[model samples]
Target: MNHAMATPTGNAAAKITRLPFLPLASSAVAKPRNSSRANFYKEVLESARDKFTRAISFQSKDKDISLAKALHYVAAEDEAYLAYNREIDAFALQNERSDTSSPHDAQGFEAVENMPMDGKNMNEWLVEIDAIAKEVEAELVSRDIGCHLAEVLEAVNKVLFETRGFKRSHVVVDSKCLYLHSVLSSGSASAILLSVIYIEVCRRLNLTIVGSRVGDEFLIWPPTGNPEELFKVTSGRSLFGIVNGKCVDDPRSKASDINSSSLLGLEIATNRDIIGIALANLIRFYWKRASKTNYGLMLTSPLRSAHRSEEKFSKDNCSEMPLLRPQELRLAIMASERLLILQPHSWALRRDYGMMLYYNREYEAAVQELSICMAFAPEEESEVLEPFVEKLHLMRLEKSWKSSLGQKGRLTVT
Candidate 1:
């Protein structure tokens, strides 16, 4: 299949290879500078000036400056900015095509806007939401829930469909389908399943459920409650509740293991983080498949081929803009930057950033970013990316060699 459409722009001479590598520095990353908001400005620009100088040196054709020396520096800071923009552009394009639903409509089902409400009464909101759920259950007719946990999903899906036209595929995408598949296929922990699904639906429905991170688990709290009332649902816990006609949890169920103030508040989860989480789960799940038959190749080959083919199909039939909604895409792009700043040493973030660059047609920049990523996180080099990079560099070398030979030939012929 034609990978041209999916591949970010550039000639064959700029790609970086995917290979086992060593850490450029280390794997440790500093935590967010602030708890509520990410102060990524300082950290993102946090680069060594020598790296920029080294990059400038590469522009020189002097024989004394070796290729390796030309490349060794703090890393290209300007390249990082260019790559960040490339990612934003790619994300915007994909989301435009995946416009299956609009997330902006704030009206609840049945024009619940004018519905009579007992003002300021928490009990009334809970009752109303349950009543809505019950009414939805009784009135709506739905096909069988085809998968596991299908019943709960069917009940909710019906509510969303009747209330807010939420399509199944959108629901699945918003849910951690990628992560769940990795977990189930790989047999890892099952903790994040329920929260992931709930959060996905909530986002689509504009229900304002905030995501939470607790210990090794994930959680969500409905926006209808005070932030203090948030619970531990993300941990795949046994209890759930409803507030203001929304499913939620009472604050009493908050995990004792967590600090009260540090709980993830009303802020929405960024698409980048969600995607990152999905990818991490995929890597972790496939970590143990070191054998030949059910090995890393087995896991990655199909995935890579499928991605390539899907990219080709999308290109042939349609264009890939961004895979996320516009506002969501903005948040993702910002979050990715924040992540890179906070976790400068994270291989996964670097690799993702590089991949983002590659898809955006910033080939040379992608190579540089990915090289660093490979250095930090060598274990998960993509076979496809590696060959692409090698081919790119070789092509450039060949072109230069051919140009010199042609010049010599012209002189000799003269």
Candidate 2:
């Protein structure tokens, strides 16, 4: 929307513009095999296709549409779902080697493992989390729970529920813990550690928790739930009771009092979202660190490093990152795009997207995207962009100034 700051041209246009979207057709379809896991994804894709087909039912019966348009419509509804399902399938195949032994001996056997359901009873799960917290408190004397932030989070995740047959919802941490990691440790490491913990905890507990890819915060999906209702769930709780980015606790309020803006917040999101935020935060963190030095070299180092690494991987016959690489930041960008689709007004997602573009070497486009992000930032964080933007402006200024000096020197020599 901040059209004043058009990108330096090229890919920036594609990155910032609201890409025109289209719908799919009904007649073209691809049937998937019926394995349980395959079938689950297949059903989702089919349902998406069906819903899209239904929406376009009014189209002229005699008219024909391209298969590409139909695919696009289905993709628009659920890009992340399709992307992740494909990743899951590819990973399964890559691990599926010759099984000369029993079915249990298969490397990909765990792909079909039943979803964790330890939290069928909320009371029981809560008791288990409490017990694990106590154990962690007790273990501080025996083992250093403060080795690495990720390790601490991982350890807590593993011991918290495995001992008591329960799992805590996304890794719970106070503002203090996040501040320590973000300020004291490496930004990427800190973001990833917290995100992994948050995600793994939810998985263990079978809770519908997500990583809030926006801020350095995490929350369970639904903060509250009814025990008596047939489909009652505590996960996926709306934060709509929050107004102007803060929660309200009025005694007169009912559950339904929460509004759309507050309740539908995307707090617990996917790993993709986490990675996006991490990348965004990393850019800001690096920019800040570079600003204090008053040198342009700092700005180029990390990006060049990333570019080199990306090049190395490509040369090694890997076009994309391997799943075993826990810190696949690219996945986070895709996740951020998904979040942006779901919650377009989210300044956080916009920030992440801009940062992603910046790292992807779409510098001018990155600046344009980030300019929009700066405009939407709350008053408190508005100043956060001033230094970074100034640095970019200064870099350009210095380059031109030096160029002029070089030209004048050449003229003098002549």
Q: Which ten residues in a row have the lowest lDDT in candidate 1?
A: 67-76
Q: Alpha carbon lDDT of residue 272, candidate 1?
A: 35
Q: In order, what lDDT does every prediction score?
A: 0.37, 0.37
Candidate 1 wrong stretches, greater than 4 Å: 1-190, 203-206, 230-255, 264-268, 291-348, 351-414
Clashes of 1: 20
Predicted candidate 2 versus true structure: per-residue lDDT over 1-414, tens digit per residue: 233342224455345344321112111113434334444544444454454354334352412322222222333324324433564555466457554322222123221111111212222333433454555545543675554332343344445334432321123232222221221122222434343433434444333333343333333232335312212222332232110012123333232333334545544444334433433443344344334334443323332333342432121111231122122333334334434543455666676565554444334445555565655667544445534443444443555676789877855443
Best by lDDT: 2
Where is the poorest 10-residue window by lDDT in model 2? 20-29
Cα-based RMSD of candidate 2:
18.4
Candidate 1 residue-wise lDDT, 1-414, digit = tens: 234212333343134223322222111122332211112212332342233233334355433332121111111222233333444444455567795342232223231122222231223333433454554455334543332232443456455444534222212322123333222222232334434444444443335445554444455555434444344343354223321112222343344434335544324544334433533443343232212233333322322543363443221111232232232222233334434543456766776655544433334555566555544454435445554444434433555676789887765343
